[model samples]
Target: MPQTIAEKILQNHTREEVRPGRIVRCRVDMVLANDITAPLAIKSFRAMGAERVFDRDRVALVCDHFTPNKDIDSAEQVKTVRQFAEAMGVTHYYEGGNVGVEHALLPEQGIVGPGDVVVGADSHTCTYGGLGAFATGMGSTDIAAAMALGETWFKVPPSIRVELYGTPQPHVSAKDYMLRLIGEIGVAGALYKALEFGGPAVEALSVEGRMTMANMAIEAGGKVGLFAVDDKTVAYARRAGRSGNQVMAPDAGAEYERVVDIHVDDMSPQVACPHLPDNVRAVDEVAGLRIDQAVIGSCTNGRIEDMRVAAAVLKGRRVADRVRCIVLPATPSIWKQALKEGLIEIFMDAGCVVGPATCGPCLGGHMGILAGGERAIATTNRNFKGRMGSLESEVYLSNPAVAAASAVVGEIVHPSHL
Candidate 1:
């Protein structure tokens, strides 16, 4: 039987003919956890009486969330992870200045690559699927087991083919296309299913853009978001110093539960309003809605491409009075690149705060929390209640360009408007 990209990867990992809904034990290529979750996994690993991980090189621990020692509790959390890494001799550990958001950092370092089966204790682990990997998030407990055994069980997910057919307009991006998809399908639309993105439009997106789309797959209730390996995938792996030959693609006539087609030629910049990621609207619909803050970074849109877009819009302008604009680079390397490219200078001149590489404020941890009744426009993925601070505060989700343009006007607006 022909298999989809996700099914092919699983079968390659398990050496079994895996099908949708079949429970299979598969060897994982990489396992990761962040400071927020690694401590719990470490405790569980100890409880399981595992003295060493199955393979230290395949296990990664990142301290991105609430890092820079946010507070006494967060500092202690990092301390526990650091101590555990030292004791375990874990080779892929990252923290302090070396830390980046786990999702972005792993792929950039070639730690997770094409056709790999990766599991992380963070939901956005699906981001690796953009690299043609079969990646998904698991609980800390499951992660501990994977770290100890180098294997985990998964019920193979049926695939949903999301076919894209046209080029996005200026200032529109994968974030907008993803938001439009979520709006059309709702949050539970693809529950427990693999979303296999394809077609000419999707092929045209940069790897960074593809990752941004996959990073929000969980928001649509997807089990995993996958893309077929292509030249771009190979080039990206090569740039990351990975020369692995583990590339796979869906066979023709592969099965899919359904197909969702999106024609993006005329698609406008999209936004998700407060309370849910699926509550999306065209940027014009919410134009003039005042915002108290505008955040231009996160795992979703904190790459170098995102930074350049935001900088282009803010180059000759300043953030509007009373609106605090914060720009965060997802990793130390990206931060340094931005500085070298003078993107940092543009942001600083525009009165935007350039923060370190952390998940900051996206999870309401720190850096730019909102007060009650205030509003923010962010490039972060989620906009759930209390996600960025006070429950009463609102979040509007958009691409980097929209967020930057909104910052200039002190309200939600399309980049074209400014």
Candidate 2:
């Protein structure tokens, strides 16, 4: 049977070409560092008695978690990472507003691509799989080893096939389906596995929507979340400037430990209530849930399409006086495109605060702070207590349309109403 793109990336990096069921040691092609994890990784690499990296140019360090200092601790942490990146000669250093979220910035740089094994200290590193790379997250210790030796070991995880069979109804988004998946599989269900999403529903989705879905694979607690390298993947690669034709898909009889079937016709916009991603509810169930804010950006759904969707729903409509809406582009390149597309004007006219292209206010690093007992409806991934801003603040996770609609009404309402 032919292998999937995830399998090809793994095979290329394998120290030994064992069959699908066995474990293997691999020479990783790249390692990543972010503000939160780089300092610890650098410290551990030095303690290993390594004078310099195996190859400094192959490693990436991004200053995103605390850009321009959200508070005193973030500023101090930023200082530690900048000094470390400078001393180590790492080539990919993005600082202040110039820095996008770690996941959003790495793939844009052409450093990550097909048939490569990539590891990062951040959990969402699997976002690179959209390029046909086998990417996974690691702890500081694992980051240090990859940074020093450029290799790591991984058990070849058995695959699971998830099929979305029909076209979704109008106004539904990828985030909605992802939240519903987490609800079905449960948070701990897909642990240490690869989800190969296929069928018409998946192939029809745009690359940005596919990335939005794959990025949250970790939310279901899966190690490497991905889709087969179909035309959509190839087209995205070309547009992003990587320009490759190495898309891969598995054979009909390929082995999958599990198969999940999600029919698109029955699916609707989903909302993840506070505290856990898997705690998903339909939009109608929470129709009356009042919210204080709305956000439409993150590594998950902050791409250009996401911005356009919000702009379409908010044009000529004013934001509720009580609700604050903010839109952030995933990267500077996406921001530039959104500006070119005039989405920024629609948002500003709706009274939305368009933030710069950084991880700003996503993790409370900077921007969009909320007071105690407040509530927000956001398009970004994650809603753990205090994730957006204040610890006492509450967040409701939803698709961009729902978020925009809620912002207009100052309460939870379906975007289809307008």
Candidate 3:
């Protein structure tokens, strides 16, 4: 009857022991909805005749995806979210200057932490698992129900144990590690399952790196990607203003459906080819693949650490004459920090366009749209056809270091090659 970290958290909310595949109703610690998902959730809440959220403070409404409005339609969507947040007396609503990707923003602000069960209307909601929280995404309707009731039902997912070992080679980042795993597992390998990352290599990753890996776990069909609470998690939580949070870890005897071990020192920089996150290859194999653009920002890899990596590679260097590089900070706070640290100057001096903290090119909403047949290297998760523009265009996913170096060469190259 051993339990994984996710099971332990869910059981605490349910006040009972539970098993994978068992359906249970548990109190939701946090409920999140972004601009793209809030409107529908709001509509559903209204349809349910709910006049107020179960706990105003537990609900967060973030206007990020289309913030600063992409068009009249996007503006209208944001207005609806704004009006709903105001009427509900929701103190966690973030819009305008305070906006950021909800997954990244929530954890960075200490709204999510250890042992919490968070539900978000975003596929990347699983990102919170990096902090030892059991977070997952649900449809807007499910999010609406959670908002009204502060509870929801879940069919516990079986867990997959991922053990990591060895130190990563220089420039071999969490992003590359994730891409390699996804390639090995294929896109559907973990359908409806949890991926629990542990062991020495995971311990070596910074919180930002863990966040990047967890954020993309969904790309390989995982329900959630979790890491056991450790000093790194606690340090990050403290930095984000959290206190009195209890760390959670899987029982030593916890059963897993499968176990995969990765030796980080064996990994190289990796890239996910166009149209599929699992279509990955070593960076050296894809070197010199011409690219028209480079983007370094997303909930997955747009933290200050990512900026530092990109800055380190781009310092005193200029982007290739034919390449257009765009750098987006994940949040205004991160943007300010980068500015103070001269990372922003490094990007600017290298001819990279530094953008406001926004989803921007990640979702192809705006900023660096690709024309047909063009290719790009992006730090963002996802590389579905047309994800960054015309369906004929191609997207190759890499870590910030590789993306920055690629920008300098106008091709997919290893960061060390710069």
* Maximum-lDDT candidate: 1
How should the candidates be ordered by lDDT, best one leading? 1, 3, 2
- TM-score of every candidate relative to the true structure: 0.99, 0.94, 0.99
For candidate 3, report its TM-score.
0.99
* TM-score comparison, 2 vs 3, better candidate: 3
Instruction: State the C-alpha lDDT per candidate.
Output: 0.93, 0.80, 0.91
Model 2 per-residue lDDT tens digits across residues 7-68: 66677777577455678888888889888888788789889987777787888888776665
Prediction RMSDs, each to the true structure: 0.8, 2.0, 0.9
lDDT accuracy of residue 44 in candidate 3 = 99
Q: How well does candidate 3 score on lDDT at residue 132?
A: 88
In candidate 1, how many Å is residue 40 off? 0.8
In candidate 2, which residue pairs get closer than 3 Å at backbone N, Cα or C atoms, i.e. clash? none
Q: Once superposed on the true structure, which residue ranges of model 3 sit more than 4 Å away at CA?
A: none
Single out the weakest 10-residue window by summed lDDT for candidate 2: 236-245
Whole-model lDDT, model 2:
0.80
Lowest-sum lDDT 10-residue window in model 1 = 241-250
